[model samples]
Target chain A: MALQDKYAELLQTATTLGVGNLASTEQAGVLHVSGTANSTADYDALWALYAKIDPNMASGDLMMNIDIKADAGAQLKVTTDSSNLNIRSTPSTEGEIVGKAAHDEIVTLVEKTDDSWWKIKTADGEEGYAFAQYLSPL
Target chain B: MKLTKLLMVVVVSATMLFVSCKPKDADIKAAVEKALSADPSMSGTTVEVKDGVVTMGGECKDDACKAGCEKIAAGVKGVKSVVNNCTVAPPPPPPPASLSTTIDATKMQQVKDGLKDIAGVTVEFVGDKAVLKGEVTQANRMKIMQMLAAAKVLSDVSGLTDKK
Candidate 1:
């Protein structure tokens, strides 16, 4: 899809699924370069949104980046894992999910490399990248 | 000895008069500085005080700053009357890349929400028109007034002078 079309698609998804979790503001385009990939791959639309909002993040950094890129230390705590187990690439709904997370997953945040995105660990102690957008503070 | 004593008293009296009559204009300048420092919006506007007559001039970012300068001038202790000639200028905030046409409705909502996020403003938008209908601290009120004037919804905002 074209860049503008991609952004619009992401915007629509964010309006619906991101309801209370949606970001408070919008910003210009961003670029990405990371080595991580998603788990479930069901969150493609979400990753697209993230790319429009910010393009620099690697595929693995989606679930870990926050609204603003802070170098602060991160610690993740999983509060919920429902029917859908899709892992997204960016914080916004426009991003795509590259992987699937299991139920009752607890990911420990290791670092904050970009906007609200953090490095996390899965239930089986698998280290991966995620966006802070989906996780609540500990 | 008595002659010398008399000379001393005369000299002392002269000193007293000199101290008592020191320039109140300086006092007025200090007072203006004190008031402006306590308020941020008026920090940029310059105040010229001479012989207790204040002439204010500077380009503030908005009408609120202008009003703030005037109000501060009037309330200050040594001020006789303020000749507020302060000018209003736009902020250097970066221009929006593609001015996304925020709907009039969205404009009103953003105004209210934006004002609320910042302390000291109680903003309200009735219909498509936003009406800011309360008092904020003098400094904050000044800047807010300027924002209201520049606000897209309040493009035709008039009666700013009539309010005070």
Candidate 2:
């Protein structure tokens, strides 16, 4: 199913419910959302479990439906200049910049790596640990 | 035995090869849909890719839709390239047909210069007909249209119609 087709399907589903989106008058933005927490052991699993259906989210924004404080799954879209959010070669900040992000400026957090660090996407799409203070959506 | 070990190695490698080959068009299309659905950026478009050639056709809601679709299409595994036939919405009027070559060529120059700065707007004059290319954005495709309409009221070119 192409997204446009799926979007059409979703629009059809929305019309059946009488809700509409601000962007498209014929279509509705509201869709299903999982109101539960997902395990953070894996990145894909976490998103599959708790991603929200936001019809009008812009790049570099947070998933508005997920409250930061909610013990549930909150997926954050990185929307800034964090494509170069680097992790040092060693655990220490004094080390060299090992890798960089090759794609989207945003990254969703899967889990805390250690007391001071959280693993994030590196250049090759591999996950590496970064200091927790630099990560937000807390 | 030595033969058994060799057979086991060959079987495992072949299995890995089979699993990693480019999926069929149906499977690839399904994966593309799933991947786009999972991501928020690719929300309002339809895409079809066959044999590494992506055939994207649909009205994108905005420029973001165009850019987002292109970005996602670039990432699908085994995609050699894409043919972007996707149309963005809020479409601009089709260029006016040439009616005659008698309109003042200098006046057409002024109109062309005024509208070119506007993104996606193209202006061409054929006799009394002024063909506009590119649709409207936040800058207003109507701005030029309004100017032309008003100019007609003030000048001899008032006979200019968008339909040409």
Candidate 2 similarity to native, TM-score: 0.27
For candidate 1, the lDDT comes to: 0.49
DockQ score for candidate 2: 0.01
Lowest lDDT block of 10, candidate 1 chain A: A31-40
Q: DockQ of each candidate's interface versus the true one?
A: 0.02, 0.01
Best by TM-score: 1
What's model 1's lDDT at B100? 33
lDDT tens digits, residue span A21-47, model 1: 233223223211111122212233355
Score every model by TM-score: 0.29, 0.27
Displacement of residue A40 (Cα, Å) in model 1 is 52
Residue B128 in model 1: lDDT? 38
Question: Which regions of candidate 2 are displaced past 4 Å?
Answer: A1-138, B1-16, B19-21, B38-44, B91-164
Model 2: lDDT of residue A54: 19
* i-RMS of candidate 1: 18.3
